[model samples]
Target: MTRNIWTFITCGLLFSAAAVHAQSADIIISKGTDKTTIDASPFGASDPAGRMFIQVLTADLVRSGWFARGAQGASEYILSGSAGGGGGFVAQCRVAARGRSGTVFDRSYRGDANEVRRLAHEAADDILKALTGRDGMASARIALVGTLSGHKELYMADADGQGLVQLTGHKSVSITPSWHPDGDRLYYTSYAKGFPAIYELNLRGGSIDRVANYAGLNTGGVVSPDGRWMAMILSRDGNPELYVRRMPNGDPVRLTSTRRSAEASPTWSPDSRQIAFVSDMSGRPQVYVVGREGGQPRRLTLRGSENVSPDWGPNGLIAYSSRIGGRYQVCVLDPRSGDVKQITAPDADYEDPSWAPDSRHIAATRSIAYRSSVYLLDTLGDPPVALIDQKGDWTAPAWSPGR
Candidate 1:
């Protein structure tokens, strides 16, 4: 069977001119020489759900690039929590720094039994914020299309690959699941009507609606950060090209005009001014960027045999899958300096890298022996770890932006 090219999947500040410059100059970059060690104490020993919370919290912290799990000996921070209740589980969490000697985070979360994991994730994120002065991805989720039930279906899971829920029951073929910045909605392509069309799934209410149903192709729909524009691929005019359409309902403004070549995988820059997409106009598919208002497109990747699945991150970096030698690997490119860094090893093929909101980790599909599973790669130092232990052919992993 031929590999499906599309199936491989897939900021900003303001300030015055001179006053902003002075403030930016005052910003200091901190360079750390050692990883922060954290000891995560078991949550509720008597409650089964509480124990589950503890397990997930520890795993989430370990997966975070800034922290490591270990004993309290010589530990920089300690996280302890408890969960229990009769009608609903209540989690009381506390985090403290060893040297500072005061409680850094203390809070209580109350919800149904099913919310134990979510409460734990919230505590983990809070701990991260208290320690690193940055947000955490523990509470975030990932959207993907998998073949677990023998058909391509849309599924959503926690960032750690737990709480798997099928978003779409199309049971036909769904691909390219893209999350809105709010993380409550998703846009993807499905063949439920026997033709490729883009559909939006409201995760909160479980409502599905078709967003784009043009004549030819309606795939690779990516909603901008502002939720005002959607950059997608539509071939209604002639050849497959990149186009940006207004949210809800609006005619698309074509961005690419190559008459013979095709384009796929459109992504938006942090400021939503430019879009990075895949194009074959140069004979072989390569990554290219174009303005949202429809202008000339400039090629971005020049060294890879084939470059596709461009994901513009919140940190001003673009992550894509590049074919090196004979295997596909995840590569990050600095659009400003044209510097490229390959993040995956040569032993396995990794594809469809989606950046975590923190911009320090990426979730991608690692394939071996025709079996594919999602793996999270920390951009800093740790080795890639499997996102889930389930058996399935997972692809097109999209990490949710921070809530």
Candidate 2:
């Protein structure tokens, strides 16, 4: 068998339906961290909406790996809010620092009475940006592949796994979902036509267009951050290699000319000039970076046996999975310093790491023998949190860009 994009296997395991967790944002996780501690005042526990708002907001903050909810007076920042108004869900939130004389952020967010989770997500992102001056991922969406209807299809949800909406009903196997730069569209590969073809799915209008229907492998399609070109793995001429083409029906520019080795999983740099991808040129699979103008490919990973699925974040760090022993673990690499760090525990089998918009969290696939679920892993050493609780082997998570 030729080793290529389709040769990769996550595990041929049976699917088990995961129990639906309580849909409300009411649970308060009891984990403490040494990160900057923040706490909230009572948001009218009598009002269910109020309780839910605080819980969801605090949970997002904790999951960012930067803040931990603490006691009223023991934290660095205090969050107070009039959670729900008489008729609607409201977030009249105020964040006051311990020593600062004025509040850090004072804003009001209002939405429908039933959309408490949505309101909390918006407010959490606002508070995170106001405090740290960094982009918040709480309000972003994640696109992934699921096998709920006895076939691989597209599924999307909020950053916290709320408002999960299945996007595709093709009843065909779909994989390798990559979000468009505008965040309003996704590029995925589907076998609906009996062969691997790349299609673009527009989220706003629910329209699908065929982007690549080449002779051989047509997969790993992604748009550059600058929105000028698209990159994918194509084997129309020969073995699967990396190609970049101008958007809107431009001719492709082949970058790799290897006959014995196959290339896959291409990720663009923040500047959209360099692409980091996986290849088997050195015997085993490894990561290599090449310029968009077609130059020499430089090896990036020497610490792992099979390093694949590289996602380059705007913060300039690349996150990927490293095979250790019999299982794969999530790891981060600093291309500037050539240093590597293993963020997640090595015991579990985790792969297909995708970076969140904030660059602090990653969406990855965690396989447990016979089942797989999308999980959230913090780069700051926080424990993994399952993104989707409802079952059916979710994999190939693709995080959308921040607005």
Mark the regions of model 2 whose C-alpha exceeds 4 Å error after superposition: 1-33, 85-88, 99-101
TM-score of 1: 0.89
Error of 2 at 127 (Å): 1.1
**Candidate 2 local lDDT, 1-403, one digit each (tens):** 2211111121110001001221111111223236888988644444878788888888988877778887877889988867765776677889999877888889988888778887888888888889988788998889999998789999999899888899988899899999988999999999988899999999999999889998989999989999888999999988899999999668888999889999999999999999999999999898999999998899888655799999998889898988865688776777766555556554478889999998878999999886999999877546689999886899989899987
Winning model by lDDT: 2
lDDT of 2 at 129: 88
Off by over 4 Å in 1: 1-33, 42-44
Q: Clashes per prediction?
A: 0, 0
Ten consecutive residues with minimal summed lDDT in candidate 2? Answer: 10-19
TM-score list, all predictions:
0.89, 0.88
